[model samples]
Target: MATTTASVMGPHQKYAFEDTTSLLKDINRLPLFMTELDPTDGEGGSNLALEALQALAYEGTPFEIASNFKQQGNDCFSLKHFKDAAEYYGRAIAAILQNDKKKEETSGENSTDKAELAETDEHGSPLQIIDNCGPNADDDEAEKLKELVTTCYLNRAACNLELKNHRRVINDCAEVLKVQPRNAKAYYRSARACLAIDKIKEAQECVERGLDLEPQNSYFKNLAIKIMQREDYLLKVQQQNTQREFMRKHVVRI
Candidate 1:
């Protein structure tokens, strides 16, 4: 003879439970099971609970939430908080991926319904469409997500460079280039990372590619100069070491 009631997240509304084992169990599973919810209104109280949970995560759509995270990353980057910026960018990327996955699932379900409906259509079937579906479906949102993710990768690369994580910088820059082949900043960051590891030829190639994309980029030009200087310094050191070895081997005979 116990009663339990769920409450909305905001305000002083609290639920009282005497033996609410089922409700407590569901609340515990909210984080893991929320993503599995139908998102539509048919799934009883679970759907409503999922919506409230999502609203608590962010105040808008997935794209908007991802954009907000990206902006936060940029703000941290501007203040030179490289580690914090990387974390924010990571969250933004996760949000975008999660959004895309949900959209794909919804699209698949709609496509199945439409295919079934088309079988019984007298007038070529009334097209059943999801909110975002088809070839150009959410294309604008797709492009925005791509741009945001690319920017985040490039920004994270910059942070890695500042942190002297040269290998990670190279990897992040490579990721950006995968998304945006002609990104000058990606090439620039990759080139800088290559130089840090004494990858002269790779650095040169990166700089050349970057300069090919942006012929008048002062940053690329300066980096190219620095690479040339480092190469010269390395060559001089190598020659000195070779001479020292030769003298040590022959002078020992004398």
Candidate 2:
């Protein structure tokens, strides 16, 4: 009601939000599905697929991330992501105070810093857990801490990847593999980073590991193909260069 009311009142300047989970829950019928597809199929301007995905995609909500911090040692724990509204609110408080604490600590300046303590994210949960639920975390508290730590590594690894930090991405992938050896995505992501960094052997190993984990996966197979092509191309180029250099140095007089 509030959302509809806000839109009607705001009219030309209206902005509104909807809960994607709830919306998906209500659309279980085929007739309704056609109606839903109609908006998405509109060929012109922004359509339903883009808009719906934006609503459901992982958003960078800082407070929600911070509130779920974890230590590297704990096993049993809880990680409940706050509602979007609440998380946004928490983010506001987190950002400002986070800077202050950093400067204070840097200059050896001490201040009333409870927010700093909470905000000093060692490892973030959103980055680690495949789902909110953990396997060992369900019964053991100690494992939860490690999971949280694992998540932090993931978040940083992602940030690094965004900055084109492939080496660090590899490092993060390694960290994840240490904890979750069967993480196919991590292996795949690591292989991608390795390829970017010109680490062909490492990339091959990672991709092969991923393929071993999921032999029937089309995506993984595609990734392996890409790697093989790249490595083969590099080898070919190197051989060509070597042959060219040798021929130039040992050319016989006509």
Best prediction by lDDT: 1
Residue 202, candidate 2: Cα error in Å is 1.0
Which portions of model 1 show Cα errors greater than 4 Å? 1-60, 100-136
> Whole-model Cα lDDT per candidate?
0.68, 0.52
For 1-254, candidate 2 gives per-residue lDDT tens digits of: 45544443532322134365544533522233532333333335545554464233223333333333222111111222222222232233232224321233244422223223323345342234332333333434435434544555555445455557687678666766876899887888798888888888998898888989999988778878888899899999999999999999999969
Clashing pairs in 1: none
Candidate 2 wrong stretches, greater than 4 Å: 1-139
* C-alpha positional error of residue 1 in candidate 2 after TM-score superposition, expressed in Å: 38
Return the TM-score for each candidate structure.
0.62, 0.48
Error of 2 at 114 (Å): 15
Instruction: Count clashing residue pairs per candidate.
Output: 0, 14
Q: Relative to the unseen true structure, what is the C-alpha lDDT of residue 36 in candidate 2, on a scale of 0 to 100?
A: 33
Least lDDT summed over 10 consecutive residues: which range in candidate 2? 71-80
lDDT of 1 by residue, 169-210 (tens): 887777667657898989999999999999999999999999
lDDT of model 2, residue 44 = 52
